[model samples]
Target chain A: MPGKSADKKPSFSDTFSVVGGNFDDAGRVSSRIKGILKKMCLPFEVIRKAAICTFEAEMNIVCYAQRGDITLSVDEDRIVIEVVDQGEGIPDIDLAMQAGYSTSTAKIREMGFGAGMGLMNIDRYADDFDITSEVGKGTKLVMIVNITEGS
Target chain B: MELGFIVKNLKLMVRSGSENLTVDVNGGYVGDLLSDVIANSKQGDIWITRQIHQNIVAVATLKDLAGIILVDNNEPARETLEKAIREMVPVMVSELPCFETAGRIYQLIAAREK
Candidate 1:
């Protein structure tokens, strides 16, 4: 089981790798992350929110990056998911964060994604969200979801 | 409502995950956007959409949805069927359009609640 002691420090951490342009395996990491979080016995709301954010972040990597890694860490106080991808990074973070803005290709749209809501959705679910990208390099996202209710 | 009941009532053709038809469906959501469905759909809500890509299965799995009904007679792609089967996420087909499909399912769920 996941580690949980009297102190509220992180007790679990694992990183899952994701390959870019592999639509066939997209969301695999997120699903595994969800399973891990479930085993940790977090609240339903926290698991759902974390799963949603992780899935969106994973999708972004599969659709845009060459490769990526998602690190999931949990503690008594919060769950932290960090996604780092090697891909063509976003040129304009502000525009990309918009609800309907997207740079996805027609193929991505045909797959029912790239509506420009991935980042926004991640931001919505995460209690703390941060994103950074370098053009032609890569992007990194950090999302934290508090384990306590309303904390 | 049980997923099997909805399939029988709606005459939805189960394309994959036949063993999972026994699962319970708590509600219904109709949308083609993956993000919208992931963001708003509750667990056990049967998702109705026209998208047939494999990613649809991924979304359904992530949300713990009861199942997916592809409206407008859209057929699930080969890869989609494989993924759905592997994930045990039911994928069904409906000849009706999204509007009609969502309306009928909504009525059924409402009637059940009433």
Candidate 2:
């Protein structure tokens, strides 16, 4: 008979570094996380949604925060991600959540994002999202996606 | 040549899936707006645009396109370029604007199939 061995299975995890306001390195973190999720053969739709969510969070780091980190952990039941950034904290989280409220500069607008959909997209895609911030300190985002029972 | 060939001929760098450059382009789509591209771009088709942000990569990655071409000498921000290179997705830069680049790509892909 198997003892405690049956209870332990190999765990899969991934972490990525997102530099602060570094346009040159902006999406690297999200792309890495996206690749691993794909290789795992997770649901295509789910992965796509998560990619959008991740990108929004990643962009926030590049735009608002000086630097950030994205962490991906796949448990038996859910996938959890934490986006931590130390930058000019959001002065008005509620305003930023508004669909069209954007603080993107001309430079950022030139790139075709910053229409103020970042937070909305993240909230829309993730099962749960929570943001904590201090005006001059920084912002911390916690997002989670529940794997559909058998999925 | 096919779209894939044009991507190769242009010496467009592959930022992701470097081993799988053999793309089958059913058609081509060019736009600067991420929403439009996301809404209209078909899977396995080449996408041309001038937007150079990390979001562009996210859009393409999610859209699952054949590749992305930053037309009119447009280059993504350093961070974006680095991400593209790391992802191994194909990206080409050209000095032609939206229309000319699309036309050339169209002609190339069309000529190949015939």
Candidate 3:
């Protein structure tokens, strides 16, 4: 298995900040993270999955939050991405998880986003996913992608 | 089929990454929704859309798409074109509507397959 030998400690880690309502630079952080992963020479599948999850998380922060931070840490066996945002948190996680349910405004839709599929896309790509939010506090997401098969 | 051929056959205006048009196009995907494109677009598939945002360039890069074709004469945002040039992802424009552009490209690829 690549990146897996004897140690399981993280070999690379980085955190990126996203400012809410900053549509001009929404996906820049995700692009940088993708570049980092590509340089690390991680498997193409792993890099693609991690990039998709992080991009969705970053978009959520840009669309809804006041500000947020995305942290990416890669170890021998897995890649972990955590996004924490200060925003108008989702009131109903179950409802929000449903595809095609969105609270986005006209401007967001005009930008070709906010079709209510971001969270679901992240879930579909991540090996393990966790989400928690408070009504007015913020939303937090943790997504992990395993490197080794069935590990 | 290669992206350059599509550009020539469709009479597309190359806006950025002109040198990168030789990339092979395995298929095509038409969608304006960013998430839909990101989730469903396959590698080497030329993406057809009406959106001209800089984010479209990001999606194209992330998905390893063959390139992006903007329909209805929609020009990309200035920053979008710059980013496309920098990332070496070809961006083209077509005067036709999204449906017609998609249909023509689909026919081209389908014909090549046979």
Candidate 4:
């Protein structure tokens, strides 16, 4: 329940890279993100929501993309996460966002990811969410969660 | 409901984080899908799942769940157990399957709530 204070966190953007099929280390990025957010002494619900979004994004990269980077930053009133990944981009972004539809291979499913809830969970918790992708190219997500209520 | 009481009553294996045995269990949720738990589980709920991976701990911590009860006689990987301790999110296991574990936990929580 105790976390490092914000004074110890990186002031600006902090980026972490994800490699596809790295199930063993998939949660590391989000774990660090949660720690930094906690150190910043964000509200309990705010930290929890951000951590969920962060973990969902990391799992998406590990389950589908060949490689990706998650960049995190925070301002006075909000936190922003930018995720960019290179892999088999979603052919239908709309369908993909629907809960319970997943294109994950059997292999990925066996590891307990790829249930198709990642993107939706990310968007559900964020105050602002945008996703763009092209087939055979990559996907980019810019998600923002307001730190203070109704801000 | 304390995590220790459930572990003892169910005869589950204390795979990790014994120091956290006293965490209060407010209720219970049954799900294996990571997102389902992340999206639906309430804070302080005990999660019953077949998953025994490190991500299990990640979701539990993120949701602020009281602890995780792994069913189906599955054993968590060494790293999975290690992460439970590191995150201080207790993980326990029962030889029973997921549904049965949920049923029993439901009864326990129901009685406690009453």
Model 4, range B30-101, lDDT digits (tens) per residue? 887888888789999998988887878888877778888889888888889888888788888898888788
Q: Model 4 chain A, poorest ten-residue lDDT window?
A: A1-10
Global local distance difference test of model 3: 0.91
Query: Model 1, A16-46: lDDT tens per residue?
Result: 9999999999989998999999998888999
Q: TM-score for each prediction?
A: 0.94, 0.71, 0.94, 0.90
What's the TM for chain B in candidate 2? 0.82
Clashes of each: 0, 13, 0, 1
DockQ of structure 4: 0.63
Single out the weakest 10-residue window by summed lDDT for candidate 1 chain A.
A1-10
User: Please, what are the lDDT tens digits per residue for candidate 3 over residues A20-74?
Assistant: 9998887889889989888988888888888899889999999999999999988
lDDT-superior candidate, 1 or 3: 1
Q: Give the alpha carbon lDDT tens digit for every residue of A1-151 in model 2.
A: 4545225442676678788667766666776787888888887766666676777788788877777778887765556788888888888999989988988888777767677877877787788899988887788888877666343
TM-score of 2: 0.71
* Tens-digit lDDT track of model 4 for A1-151: 2653344453567899999888888878888898888898888888878888888998999888999999998876678899999998988999999988999898778767788889989889987899999899999999888788533
- The CAPRI quality class of candidate 3 comes to medium
What local lDDT does model 3 show for residue B2? 81
For model 3, name the residue pairs that clash. Answer: none
Give one digit per residue, the lDDT tens place, for model 3 in B30-97. 99999999988888999999999899998998888999999999999998988899988899999999
